[model samples]
Target: MSEFSISDIGLKVGLEIHQQLATNKKLFCNCKPIESEEYSIKFQRKLRAVKSELGEYDPAVLFEKLKSKTIVYYANSESSCLVEQDEEPPHNLDNDAKDLALVIATSLHSKIFNEIYPMRKTVIDGSNTTGFQRTMLISQGGQIEVDGEKVGIQSICLEEDAAKLLGDKGNIREYSLDRLGVPLLEIALDPVEGDSKKIKKIALSLGRLLRSTKKVTRGIGSIRQDVNVSVKDGGGVVEVKGVQQLDQLEKVVEFEAKRQFGLVKIAEKLRNSDFEGISKRENIFDITENWKSCKSKIIQKALKDNSIIKAIKIENFSGMFGYTPFEGIRLGKEIGQLVKFYGIGGVFHSDELPNYGIEEDDILIVRNILKVNQNDAFLIIAAPSSKIDFAINSIINRLEEAKKGVPAETRLATQTGETVFLRPRPGASRMYPETDIPPISITNQELENATKNIPKSWDESLLELQKKYELNSQLSEQIFDSRYIELFEKIVGKIKVNPTFVASILCSTITNLERNGLNSKLLTEENIVKSFQLLAEGKIAKESIEIIYESIMSGKSQTIDEALRNASIETIDEVKVEEIIVDVIEKNQEIVKNQKERSIGPLMGIVMKELRGKVSGEIVNNLLLKNIKKKLGNI
Candidate 1:
C-alpha cells in the first residue's frame, strides 16, 4: 500500500523484454542451446573496449575495460562450439527463430521488414565472447492493449543471448558458453503512463502473448526485463536491469521513481541552502587508530586482514543520509551503492551512529579530527590499503551525483526489489553493423505464411482449457503460464483420464515437489507424457504420479516404468490390497477397538509402507475402514 501517486512525480516508464526462443540449436551454430554440468573445455580471455568505425568509445564498455577483469568460459562439445569462443565466425541466422519473430510481430500488429540485417552491439561486461552481441531488427511500430489502453510497441529485434554468468570470483569472471548464441527476441515498447500497477499488468500480458505462441523457453533465466523510469523534473531516465520476476517488477519501477524524486529534492535543497564545503572537501582521514578497541566483528575482521579504514566528513548532510523516499531505502543506503563497487561490506554513517560497537566517544573523536558541525555527517569504510583511495573517491562521486539529482546509469536489481549502481548507461556509440552477417532479404511468402499460421492467443487457449479440462482458474493459469500447456492438452486428448486428475498431477503435485526443494524443471516433457501414458494404460496407479515425477526429477529413474520399479511399485491387485489391510486391522484389533476410526492414521501408515505407488491410498483407506468396522462391530 504505497500512497505515492505516479502523477505527482510526472514519471514515465518503458520496458524492453527479452525472451529466449525454444529452438533446438543455437542461433549461430549447430550446437544445442542447453546448459550442461559436464564442461570438458575452458578458456580465458581479457575483453577491451574498442572504438567504433568513427573512433568513438562506449562509456559503459570503457568502465568494464578499466576493471581489467579476466573472463573464463566453460564449454562442452555437445553444448557449444567455436562460434561462442570468438575464434570462429558465426553461421547464418536461425530460420525457426525468424519464423517465431515474424509470427510475434504480426500478432502485435507490427510491420515486418522485407530485409533484415544484423548489427553488432558493443559489450565488454564479459557476457559476450566477441565483445559484441549480434542483433537484427525484424519489425517496428505495433501496439498491444493493456488495461484497455494501447501500449505502443517500438521495435522487435532478434538477438543472440549473452553467455550464462557462472560466478564472478574476484578478478576472474566465469561464464558458460551454453547460453551464448541462443536466439531470443527483444520487444521494445514506447513509454507509457507511470503507473506501477499498470506496468506490471502490461508485462504479464506481453509474457502471456509470447508464451502462447509456444515458441519461447520457460525458466528463471529464460526471460529478463530492463525497466527505464524517469520523472520530468527529477532527472534523466535510469535503466534497471535483470528484472526476471513479474511480481517484483512493480516494486523495481516504483523504487526507481522514488529514487529519482528523492535525488531531485536533495539537489534542490543543496542549491537553496547555505551548506558549504560539500564540493570543497580536501581529503579522507585515516581513522583506523581511533577504533583500536572496537568490538564490531566486521571492523575487527578488516583489521585482522590488514585492511585500511578511512572516514570522510560532509557538512550540512546530517538528515539527508536517513531521508527515505521509498520504503526500506534511505539516502545513506544510496551512498552504500558506491561502496559496494569497491567490493566492501557497507558504509557506516553518522545517521546510524552509536551502534556497530562504535561508541559515542568514538564518534566524538572522529568528529573532532574532521571538525564536523551539527549539520554535518560522515562516512566510514574499510577496504584494502591499495583500494582505499578508490573507495573514498567512490563516495565522493556519489555525493556529487546527488547534487545533480539521479545520474543516468545502469543499475542491478536486488532480491529486496531495490536497485544499485552497476555502471554508466551506454550510448548509441556502442553499436556498429556486423560485417560478417550480411543483410537478409525476407520475401513476401515468408510473411504470408507466418500471418496465415499465427498461434492462438493465450487467453483464448486458457478459456478452452478451463472448459475442456474442468480446471480451476488457479490450476489452469499455472498450466497455461508454463510451457507444458500444450503438452497437458496433448495428454488429456489422447489419454483415458480425467482432465482434473491430470491437471492436479501436473499442477499440484509438481508444485508440492518444488515446495520441498525438488527442481521440477528437471522433469522432462517426455517423461511427463510417459507417466500419463502409464496411467492411461494402468501400468501405474494414479497415486504413483508424485513418486514417478519425483523419481524422474531426482534422476532415480529415466522413465515411468523404471520409476515404478525403483519405488517398488510392483503390480498389486485390489484383492491383495484388501488382504493386506485385513491383516493390519486384525493385528491391531485391540488398538482399533480402543481408538475406533482414530486408528486409521497408524493403520494407513502400516499399509502404505508396502503398497505405496502400487495402489491408490483412497482405495486402501476405504477397504481398511470397511474391514475395521466389521471387526469392531461398530458399523
Candidate 2:
C-alpha cells in the first residue's frame, strides 16, 4: 500500500452515514419504534421494478425482480400498522423527526432548505414493502472540520428505514416491519481530499458530532455507513454498503483503492498483451456432462439435482484471475460476489482448480474443451437449469467489465472490513418523486428553533453534567453518550435525591443490567422515574434499585410498588444497620481477634449478603468499621 500515493492514484472517497434517530414514533406513522423480531403476523408479497422518474429503469432492482424472490413481512399490533402494510396512506410528516434532522443540519452548518420533497429510491430487494424507500433532502452544503481540515458535507436527508432482513430460504426472504418506518437521518459527506486513512478520520469526526446531539440511537445496527470510492483511472465509483464500525472505514477504502488500481493494471495489460479471439463466441463454453463423478460436495449436490454447469474461458487472464488485488481478496473473489448476488452457491476458476476436489484430469478436459493454453483461465458455476441464464450472463458481464477496468457496482462490507460485490451501482435512474405526500415547507422561525434546540457538543455536555450534577467525568460522559441524559435530567429536576444517584443508575447500573441479560428496554423511563419517586419517599433503599429493576424487566412486576413488594426491601435505617453489624461481629468475635482489620471486610460481606438490598453499602461499611474496632479493643 505504501508503494503508491493516494493522490497519484486519484483516490476520491465520499461517506454516507445513516443513523436511526431516537424518536417516540415511526417516521410516517403513529406506531411504536420497536426493535425486537418477535411478531404475531407474517405475510408474503412479490414486487417488480418499474421505470424511474427519468424513464430509466434501475438494473439492480431489475436483477432482484428477475430472481422472483418471495418476501415475508412480519408485523405486530404495537410497532407495525397499516402504514407499514401500504394499505393506508401515511400520516403527516413527523415534525419531531424533521426537527431532529434540522438540529443536526444546524450543528453541521448546513444550508437549510425552505422546501423538502420526498422521493422514492427504487429498492425491490424486499427491504421495503412499497418497493421503494421514501427519502427527502432537508439541507445541503454543510461542513465539518476533521484534524483541522474542512470535510465538506454535501447534503442531509431524512428517510424512512427499510425492513430488517431476518432470513432467506431459496426464493423466500423473511423481513420484519418493526424497523421499516423508523426515521433515519442520512448525511452524505463530500469527496474529501485524502487517502484511505484521512477518510476514516473524517468519518469518525462526523459520527462523533452526530452522536454529540444525544438524539441518535446507540447500539448495533442503529447506525450504518456507505462509502463511495473510486480511483483516477478506475471505471466508476463503487459503493460499499453497511460498514457499521468506524475502524472498518480505513480498511474498506484501502482495499477498494487497491482493487481499482489492480483492475486498471489488468485492463492495461490486456490492452497491450495478446488479447486474442478478440470478439469471438469461443469465450464461454459448455463442459457440463464431462464432469459426472466429481468428488466436490458442491458439484455432487448440483449433479444430484440435475443442474447444468457453465464455464467462461478468458484468454490472457490466467495469473490475473488469481492475483491479489487487495490483501486476502483476489480478483476471483469478485466473481464470488456475483454468485452470491445472483443467488447461486459457488463458482470455480481454473486458477483455483486442481483443488476443491476437482482432479487434474478434469482440468485437462476443460483446457481441451475450450482449447485454452497454459496462459488462459476458465471460470465455472453450477446451478439449476432454470438459473443458467442468470449465472452465465453475470459471468459474461463481469468479464467484459474487467477488460475495461473496475466495474461500477455496489458492494457489501465483510467481517474483515473488505468488500464483496452486491449489485451494479444504480445511478440517477433509481430515484422518482413520491406523489402521495405533499412537499414539506420549512419556515425561518422553524429553522431558528431547531438550531436553538441543538444540544451541547459532547465535550461541553460532559463538563456541564459533571459540574451541575457533581457526577464523575466518566459517568457524565456515559450519561450523554448512552442516550440517557434526557431522562436523567428530567428525573433529577423533579426528584429530591442526589443527581449523581440518577446519573449512576442511568449511565452505569442500567448498562450493567443489560450486560447481565436483563432487558433494560423493558424497564422504561417511566418505570425509572416512578422507582426514583419511591426512593425519595423512603419507601425503598437505593441498593434495591437493581433488584427492583430486575424484577420489572423480568416481568415479575408490572408496577413499581409490586416490584418493591417482590424485592421485600426495607429502609434498614442506620440504627438497625448498627445493630446488625454489632450482632454480626459478636458472632464472629474469634475471627475478628485472629485477623483484626481484615476480619472487617469478610464480616461486612457476610452481613451485606444476608441483608442485601436492605441498606446502603456506605452505611454498612461505616457501621461495620466502627463495630470491628470496638470488638477488637474488647478482645
Best candidate according to TM-score: 1
TM-score of each: 0.86, 0.80
**Poorest 10 consecutive residues by lDDT, candidate 1:** 274-283
> lDDT by residue for model 1 over 1-635, one digit each (tens)?
13466688888899999999998888888889867888999999899889988899987887677566899999988888888998899998889989889999999999998999899999988899898999999999999997688999999999999999999866789999989999989999999875788899899999999988877898788888999888877667899999998877888988788778777877777767555544524647888888777777888999998988888888778877877655655668877776676567788999998888888888888889889899788888988876777667767876777777778889998877878889888999999899998999888899998899688887787887788778888888988876557777888888888888887777778878887878876788788888888777877777788888888788777777788778877658889888888888878888898899889989999998878888878888899888888887853
Number of colliding residue pairs in each model:
0, 0
lDDT of 2 by residue, 1-635 (tens): 22566678888899999999988789999898876757988888999889876677888887787788989999988899999998898898899899999999998899988999988898989999999899999999979888778888899999999898899888899999889989999999998657877887777677777777777887668888999988887887899999987767788888788778878877776667665532336576766788886677788888888888877777877776677644554668777778776678878988888898888888887788888887888887888877777777877677777768888888989868778888887878988888899999999988889878877765786687789989888877767656566788889889999987888888778778777878876787788999889888877778889898889877788777788788787776788778878998888888899999888778878988877888878878888888888887877
lDDT of each model, Cα atoms only? 0.84, 0.82
Q: Quick one: best lDDT, which candidate?
A: 1
